[model samples]
Target: MKDLKGKVALITGGTKGIGYGVAEALLRQGLKVVITSRDENAANEAADSLASKTNSKGAVIGVQADVRRLDSQKEAVNQALSTFGQLDIVIANAGLGHFGSIEELTVEQWNDVIDTNLSGVFNSIKASVDALKESKGYYITISSLAGTNFFAGGSAYNASKFGVTGFTQAVMLDLRQYGVKVSTIMPGSVSTHFNGNEPSDKGAWKIQIEDMGELVVDLLKMNPRTLPSKIEIRPTTPPSK
Candidate 1:
């Protein structure tokens, strides 16, 4: 991490939003990057766009992977290793939310939220832990403030993020002895397409995707002895309630 140049990173759900932003930041820092999306076309398009925008010292590639399936995640890790020869960072950024009162939430909706937001994080780490250990690398998961706070209609989203927060903390303990660092980032609100929201000028008050990207870069560059295991970020201000 001292040089960052030429290090390799594998990011889940990197076609857009936070994942895409993080990929761009890492590329600018001279780290080769592999971004995955369930949609092959989106993944390739995003990679091409990022390559065109950044005068990166490193390179970027796109892969088709689904975090919900362990095999898919494993394939992504393999692709990264085959393409870049090493994997130094893994970001579990793919996530989704389904909000509704418990009574109104369907079984399918609950499954979708848990599968993509919680189980997905597990799959990402499980797939890349060995590569990380080999490189003495870093693993980061994108959680949310809802992980610690709860609301009436946020049962599914809350449960998944809460799981992510706890899981990442425990994984940190498990991996630190091997010289791998683990951390989870929890953000209150961001300008992204999550839950069908559009990113636009109206959301200027919210945390920008680039802000999250910067945080990840900071974490990766932090001194090896220091670990900021859990971080919670929120907008500086919000409109009057």
Candidate 2:
């Protein structure tokens, strides 16, 4: 909390979207970042791009990991420590969405959403808890407004995000005593290439990835006595019906 410079952060699903934005923001703040993705090529490419964008050499590391697997999360944590020598922040940003009515949703798809969006966070925190405890670090999760708002086709996605919101709040209570901060950032309608959509100026009305990145930085800068356990951010204006 005292300083972010020279701090190390490990972000899952950081090759693109919100995760990528956060990596860029932190790197600009002089933090070493470890970005993880399921694809080795994508992870490496993202790390390289982040370094280039920030004009920071070797400050961004890439680890190929699938958040669904606890071992993969642990490997990412190990890589962050091995490469950067210490970890002060962990971002559980890996997530997936499978939208369908309860009747139309398959068991496999349901499991995928729950595992990646909910359990993935638990695994990431578990892997980094020891290091975070030692460093008095921060744990952040990128949730969604859908966590609290339910829609007809969002059965699986809603359940997962709702679980994340509740889980993160409980974790905040559990970890605050150790000086490790925990928070969940829930954004509504971000203009990222999430699901199958592309990010373009056409969707500019939605929240920008960079905006979310800045929010992360703001949370990191807060005084240790204050913890915003859950944050819900929405566009100031929405498209008319």
- lDDT values of the candidates? 0.94, 0.93
Off by over 4 Å in 2: none
- Please name the candidate that would achieve the greatest lDDT relative to the true structure: 1
lDDT of 1 at 163: 98
Worst 10 residues of 2 by lDDT: 1-10
**lDDT (Cα, tens digit) per residue for candidate 2, span 168-195:** 9999999989999999999999988889
lDDT of 1 by residue, 37-150 (tens): 999999999999999889652399899999999999999999999999999999999998888899999999999999999999999999999999999999999999999999
TM-score of each: 0.98, 0.98
Residue 91 C-alpha lDDT in model 2: 91
